[model samples]
Target: MRSEGLDLFAHGMIGLNQLKAGSLDSRNSLGAILGGGMDIQIWHGIYWRAFEADYVWAALHYSDVVSPSFPDLRRPYQNGVRLRTGLVFSYGEKKAAPMTAACSVQPTQVMVGEPVTATANVSNANPKHTLTYDWSSTGGKISGKGNTAAIDTNGVAGGDYTATAKISDPKTKHGGETSCSAKFTVKELPKNPPTLSLSANPTSVQTGGSVSLSGLSHQSGQRSGQWRQLDGECRHGFRKRQQRYAEYFRRPTRTDHRERKLF
Candidate 1:
């Protein structure tokens, strides 16, 4: 394979030469061969092939003896180096690139003024490529870096919002841009202070007798309040004259009266 499959070679050969006149001689000689050379692909297959070549190498010598004196005539080897060329074929199924990106938001529901974070997962992207991130939301200010983004819902309207993340390999020639979306809900904080009203099952109760005092509000959840009991003597003359309720009440003495907590 020297010369990268292109070249020529010459060498010497030795053989025995015998004459019918009972004269034996040894033929030891050197020679050279020159011929136009080319290689052609003979057959094509997955693993094997066939090839062929044609060439000639020979030498001729003459004797000047006028009488029959020489024992035998010497001849050069006639066969030259032969080469074979083959063809190869390979077959296989092709596969597509696995470029993809996905996104997810934690705690899909949040109150206004709370911060929510979104994360992106990328697969089959070249690590050597420079990646870019784009984040967008329907109802919040989203700030992004890398594969993560922060959603600020401080002034955002209360409703279901959809957040999207697009991851791009800008350096890639095909420009692999994959995106995914996640939905979240934002609830506005209660604006109106709780509107409460108090009432008793029995407006008038005898001394040492208990009456159920109930309160109502617009809000839901646990509520706490301090309860104080008032004596009839605390009523002013104008309230008494007008048959109105007293403005100020007495401090509660029992633990059960002051410890008013409800849900």
Candidate 2:
């Protein structure tokens, strides 16, 4: 009984020694390689056959192992050795699209001519997605376009005009179009719409009730506004990111680069 107890203790000791020499010490020094790990007897006592598992902090792997020892291990007997051979397993993941850009098309839906401004408000504040744009005219008579570059709806034909706007990132297909195209029916002009007068009695004219009218029609100039960042955070990691995107169509617009610190 005593001898058997000693034998079990020896096996446990041998296992600990093998563990230290094999990976634990090496792993501690290799924190860069994920410091935590464990070795377990995956399949043991199968007639001299034992499959050991190596859990390296994140991944699980198994290996066939052989531990050879000697009876006279005073100075640790012969060349005792523990051997390991790898087995196989696999893993993978699908990445989701990050939020890229936001846009606004004035009039969103419009008739030709009048005037239209397509504003593509963009942001990559999150995990740095991508922001992009393109512009076009629907009616031939109406020809005038611009983006953050320059917006001008000078002249155009009369029809439902849409300023197709698309936004996305470099990785996948994510786009949307909208229009604030000012629509015009080109109505006949009217004079003063009327004038001003005071009357108390309907037909008797009591000189008390008063009426006044006025209106001025003209181009409100292509829509205008300034771009601003609403949120500022770097959760997935704040990095100075340069993202590129491909569009079915591209427009050469004005871009400004300055010594601006964007945190």
Using Cα atoms with residue i matched to residue i, what is each candidate's TM-score against the true structure?
Answer: 0.45, 0.29
Q: Best candidate, TM-score-wise?
A: 1
Q: What is the lDDT of residue 86 in candidate 1?
A: 56
* Top candidate by lDDT: 1
The TM-score that candidate 1 achieves is 0.45
Off by over 4 Å in 2: 1-94, 98-103, 107-115, 121-126, 139-151, 171-263
Cα lDDT for residue 5, model 2? 9
In model 1, the number of clashes is 0
True-structure lDDT of candidate 1: 0.59
Q: What's the residue-level lDDT of 208 in candidate 2?
A: 46
Error of 1 at 211 (Å): 9.1
Write down the worst ten-residue block by lDDT for model 2: 240-249
